[model samples]
Target: MNKEEANQTQAGKEQKAPKEMDANDLPKVTAFQDEATREYMVSTKEVEPGYYLLESKSKKIRMLFPEEGKYSDLLSNFSKNEEIIGFDEYDKEANILMNGQITYYQGQSFLRKTDTMIEIISGKNKYSEEYQKENKDNTEISIGYKKSNFDNLDRKNNYSYRYFGFVKPNQSLDEGVEYSFIFTCKDDNQSCSLDEKIARDKVKKMISSIQFSCNKEE
Candidate 1:
C-alpha cells in the first residue's frame, strides 16, 4: 500500500480504538439507582400472610415463615454475631411478642421493632406425651421485624428496614403446616408507636383471614 494510504489506515484504526478510562474518568454509578432496577422489590400483590419483605437502596429480600417454630431461628440469622441492645417480651394467652435491639459493626442499631406470636395446638405435657401418642404435632408460629437506621455520618437520622416471619412444629406433617402471618412497615417517620400499631393491626387482620383447611377435607 502507499505510505499515505497506510498512514490514513493507522489513523482510522487509532480513532476506532476504545479510549482508556482513568479512575477519575470512571462514571460514579450508585447501586439500584432506580427502584425498578431492584431484583426483588415486593409488590402489593406479593405481600401475603406469614411473610416478611425487606428493601434497601441496593438490596431486597424476603423471609417466609415456616409452620411451627417461634422467631428464634429468624432472629439468630438476622443478629448473627451482633450485639443486643434492647429486649422486651409480652405474653398473652398462647401468643408472645418480643422486641429487642441488635448491634452490628455500625454502632448501636435499632431493631425498628419486633413482634413474635406463638400458638400451641395439639401438644401435651412431657410426662403424658399425649400429643405424640395421639399422633398430633406441636405447632408454633412467629413473626419478627427489624428497622435499621442508615449509617450516615453526615446525616443525623437516616434508616433502612427489614422484616422476618417463621413457623415450626414438633413434628413434620403430611399435610402442609399452618403458618402465622406477619407483616412490618418501616419509613422515615420517627413515631414508633403509630407505626407499630399500624403494623400490628395489619398483620392481625391478615392472620385472622387465613384458612388452613385443605380443599379435600372441606
Candidate 2:
C-alpha cells in the first residue's frame, strides 16, 4: 500500500482514551482513601449492583459482602493490636448480632483463649464440638455454639444463642492477625431462630471470602 493509505488505516484503528471517572459516579463502598496523602488505600470492583470485590492495602484484608448495607463500622481507630466491627438486625422484636475482632499478638492463637472464656462463662462442655474447615488459601476456621442464660428482666435484652468462630491465617512475618467472630440472637421466638440462621449464613459467606496478604502502603 502507499504511505498515505497506510497512514490513513493506522489513524482509523487508533481509539480515544477512556474518560476519567467522576467521584460522584463511584459506588459508596468502592474505595477508601488515605487522609494523609489523599491516595486510595482500599479499592473495590463492582461485581453487581450493591456487591463488590473489595481489597485493602492498610488492613491486609479482602472480603466481599453482598449485604454490605446491613453492617455498621464499630471501630473507627484502626489498630494493629486490636480492632472490632459488627452488624445487627432487629425484626419482630428479635435481635440478631454479629461481630468480629482482630488481635495481633505475635505467635499467639486466639482460639484457645476464646475457648477458655466460653468454658468459664458457660461451664465446661457447654459449647458444641467444633466444626472445622481448612481453606485452600491456608486459612483455618472452626465454628461452635453455646447457649447463654442471662439474668435480665427484659427479654429483648437477653442474649441466648452464642456462635463463635476462630480464623487462623497463613503464617509469615507480620502474618495474620488472630480473628474471632461472634454471632448471637435472642431465643425469644421462631422468627429469632430464622434470623439467626440467615445471619449465620451471611457470616459464613463473609468468612469464606476473607484473604490476608502482605499488602503494604508505600
Candidate 3:
C-alpha cells in the first residue's frame, strides 16, 4: 500500500480503537475516591475496645462500631457469617440510626412488619389501611433484594439511606436490627457542591465492590 494510504488506514484504526472497546471491559465504578478522605481503604482502621470490624473482604472495607448498644444489655443482633454477629441501632434523641431491619414478603426480601393492632386513626400509621391491607396479603417472600433508598425518618436535616433484605432464608434477622448500609452528612449544611443525588451515587458506587459473606470470619 502507498505510504499516504497506510497512514490514513492507521489513523482510522486508532479512531475506531476506543469505539470498538466493549462496555463490559470498562473498570468497575469506584466513586468513593472522587472526594479525598482519610477514611478511604477502610481495611486499615484500628479497632478500639468494645468495637468490631464489619469488613467487606472483596471491597477491602472495614468499619468499626460498638459491638452492643451503649451501656445496655438489650443486645439485638444479626447472626452474620456464623461467628460474626452484628446489630443495628438508632439514637432517638440524635435522630440517627445505623443498619436497621426491614422485612419483606415471600420471594420478596423486605416488608414493613404489619402492625395489625395499631389503629391508624390517630395518624401514628402514615401508611393507609388500604396500603397496609394490600401488602398484608402478600406472602412472605424468600431470598431477594430491594434497592436501597435514601431516607430521613426522624426528619433530621442530614441525608441518609436504609436498605434491608435476606441474602439467605431460614435465619431471620431480629426485628430491630437493620440489614442496610447508611451514610450521613458530616456537616448539617453539607458544605460541598455535590448534590444529594450525587452523594448517594457515590455511596452506592463504593458499595458495588463489596461482597457479603455468609461463612464464619477467620
Candidate 4:
C-alpha cells in the first residue's frame, strides 16, 4: 500500500481501538469515598463487665462478654448456678424445638420434664388446646411444665437443672430485645411441689427484669 494510505489505515485502527476494548481495559473510575461509608464498619467499646458494644451497618448491639474467657466463664457459671433441667435441640428440618418424642411447633417455646409437664413460655397465641389434646391422646403424655426458677434451688436429683426455652419470632429478634423462660417439675410423688413453686416464682421474677439496650446509628 502507499505510505499515505498505510498511515490513514493505522489512524483508523487506533480510533476504533477505544470502542473495541473490553470493559477491563477501560480507565479505572471509583465512586467518591464518604465519611458515612467508614461508619458502616462495626466498632468495639467496653460497656461493662461481661458486655461490649458492636457497631455496624449504622446499628449497635451490646455483645455480652466480648472476651472469650469472660464470656465462656459466665456461661459455665450460669449453667452451673441455674440447675439446667435439659436443653431442647434445634430441629433445623422441622424448624422447631425437639425434646425426645415431643416436638414443640415453631413459635411455641417451652421448658419441660420428660413424661411430666411442659411450661409454655412465649408465643402462647400460637399454642392451641386442640393441638395439645390431640397430641396428648398418644401413648406418650407430654407433660408441660410451668415457669419456675429451679436453677437457684439446691440440686435434689440428677435430672434437676435450670433451663430456658425460647422460640425465636417469625421476624428477626431486634438487637435490644431480651428473652427469658424457666422449667421446673415436681418429684415423681409430687412431694417437692411447694418448694418447686417457690423456686420457680423467684426465677420468674429475675428473668422478667432482664433489660436489653439497642443503639443503632441514624
Model 4 clash number: 17
**Whole-model lDDT per candidate:** 0.28, 0.46, 0.30, 0.27
With a 3 Å backbone cut-off (N, CA, C), the pairs that clash in candidate 2 are none
Ranking of all candidate structures by their TM-score, best first: 2, 3, 1, 4
Question: Residue by residue across 1-218, what tens digits does model 1's lDDT show?
Answer: 99999999977654431122222322122111122212222222223443322222122112221112122323322232232122222233223333422212111222111111111221111111121111112323333444555555454334323233322322322222222222222222333322445545544333233222222133
For candidate 4, report its TM-score: 0.22
Q: Estimate each model's TM-score.
A: 0.25, 0.52, 0.25, 0.22
Q: What is candidate 3's lDDT per residue for 46-86, written digit by digit as tens?
A: 24443333442232223343333221113332233222222
Provide C-alpha RMSD values for all models, in order: 18.4, 8.9, 16.2, 22.3
Once superposed on the true structure, which residue ranges of model 3 sit more than 4 Å away at CA?
A: 1-178, 184-186, 189-194, 212-218
Q: What is the lDDT of candidate 2?
A: 0.46
Give the candidate number with the greatest lDDT. Answer: 2
- lDDT (Cα, tens digit) per residue for candidate 4, span 50-103: 223222222222122121111111222112112111112222332222221101
Taking the candidates one at a time, how many backbone clashes does each contain? 11, 0, 15, 17
Q: How accurate locally is residue 48 in candidate 3, as Cα lDDT from 0 to 100?
A: 49
TM-score: model 1 vs. ground truth: 0.25
| Candidate 2 per-residue lDDT over residues 1-218, each given as its tens digit | 99999999766444211112334434443232212211222333455454454433255666653423333455322455444433333333444445554333333343345444334333433655655555646666555555556786566646555555555555443334344455556355445543456656655665666666643233
Model 2 TM-score on a 0 to 1 scale: 0.52
Who wins the TM-score comparison?
A: 2
